[model samples]
Target: MAEGALFEFLCRMGDNTLVLGHRVSEWCGHAPVLEEDIALANTALDLIGQTQMWLGLAGEVEGKGRSADDLAMLRDAWDFRNVLLAEQPNGDFGQTMMRQFLFDAWHVEMLAALTRSSDARIAAIAAKAVKEAAYHVERSGDTVIGLGDGTTESHRRMQAALDLLWPYVGEMFLPDAVDAAMAEAGVAPDPASLRPAFDARIGAVMAAATLTIPEDDFAHKGGKSGFRHSEHLGHMLTEMQWLQRAYPGASW
Candidate 1:
């Protein structure tokens, strides 16, 4: 039971990175500038690489024949455990940056805490991942601050994006049974325990950007439970899993 719970927790972490990486990858050719285009792609690659590590570890823990590729390429949207925030549509540049910033802030905090996990595999992965996540926080936070405090139009759009994405943020800190088990085992940090630091980091960014943090505590959940997901995830899977679905066992 403990192993199963750890596997699930790892998958949830991988799914979050995989789904969000795919979302960010969508900007590869469409970013507003060449520098940003490269930046987003680099960030996407970092996230996808992290997903590989976490999901690979999960497959090992499950003692199943499934490889990381099998898990990532074969899962249906309902089986994915990524948060809704990661699956949200990148409505605009501002929205994308806001979403990225929000996730990055929490991600860095989570990874830092996970580096001390009793599970050596998880700890090693988190230790390496926290470095990339710190850079991600810096990149996204800078973008948010720049755009949020920029011209009138930019500022308005940044605020709007924050408001739109805030509700989803609460889900990041909400602890469920799986989290409780992992935390108890010292395999994972308690989600609630990470919230204070997350809040402090994100609040500092928003304050610097002159943007208002949403006041509501209401959160939408379901993704971590592997039972619900945004409509965007289905479409995303169509593209991400197409090659594997179309050509079983085929590889480059």
Candidate 2:
């Protein structure tokens, strides 16, 4: 954490929600059931709402006069700070829910810790957000459990999803300089510090679902650091930012 550590940390928070919200929104009308479609849509809306608050604060902290929309739509892939997991493709309904459950587990813990952040604004935002996050985790956990313990086909797909997702889980808990500074300042917990709780939460759900965690703990990195990004994210940004980039400043 150096001169712009807070700005960097804020971007990481905002970018996670912004990117994941877009990913979740992709399920709007394509969900397997009408109930699921509506639920996913609402979940996407909640994530995007959280994005506005996080990015709004990021923009303010940066003092470069960029708005949330600018940070989200104006920047290219390498500028993003979301974990690699958030940008991963939605393979199937089962995969989608699996991704949601994993992230939701970490999210609930992260937001709960933020509720007591030394920064009042951060604490306030987390206080409001923790409520939505709680529901998100519970719903996702139930879905994971249901599909994991369901019929053979359902269980097979869920197990596959869990394997694909588990590797990415490590990145969320990997601490960096920004995290150290945030923790030191009492603004946020070190990402690593959240891992034990995340592990316990997921372990129980996985056991109920009867899914196995992958053997190798190989974690991908660089997305949050802006050093590198997966090919998927560049493509995602092309669509998400197209409207903003094509017609700069166009708005209702």
**Which regions of candidate 1 deviate over 4 angstroms?**
none
Looking at model 1, residue 124 earns an lDDT score of 97
Best by lDDT: 2
lDDT of 2 by residue, 19-74 (tens): 99999999988999999999999999999999999999999988999999889889
How does residue 169 of candidate 2 score in lDDT? 88
Q: Deviation in angstroms for 16 in model 1?
A: 0.7
Residue-wise C-alpha lDDT for candidate 1, range 1-252, written one tens digit per residue: 477788889999999999999999999999999999999999999999999999999898889788999999998988788898999988999999999999998899899989999989899999999999999999899999999989999999999999999999999999999999998888888899989988898888889899999888899888788777868889999999999999998898
Inter-residue clash pairs, candidate 2 = none
Q: After superposition, how far is residue 59 of candidate 2 from its true place, in Å?
A: 0.4
Against the unseen true structure, what C-alpha lDDT does each candidate score? 0.92, 0.92
TM-score list, all predictions: 0.98, 0.98
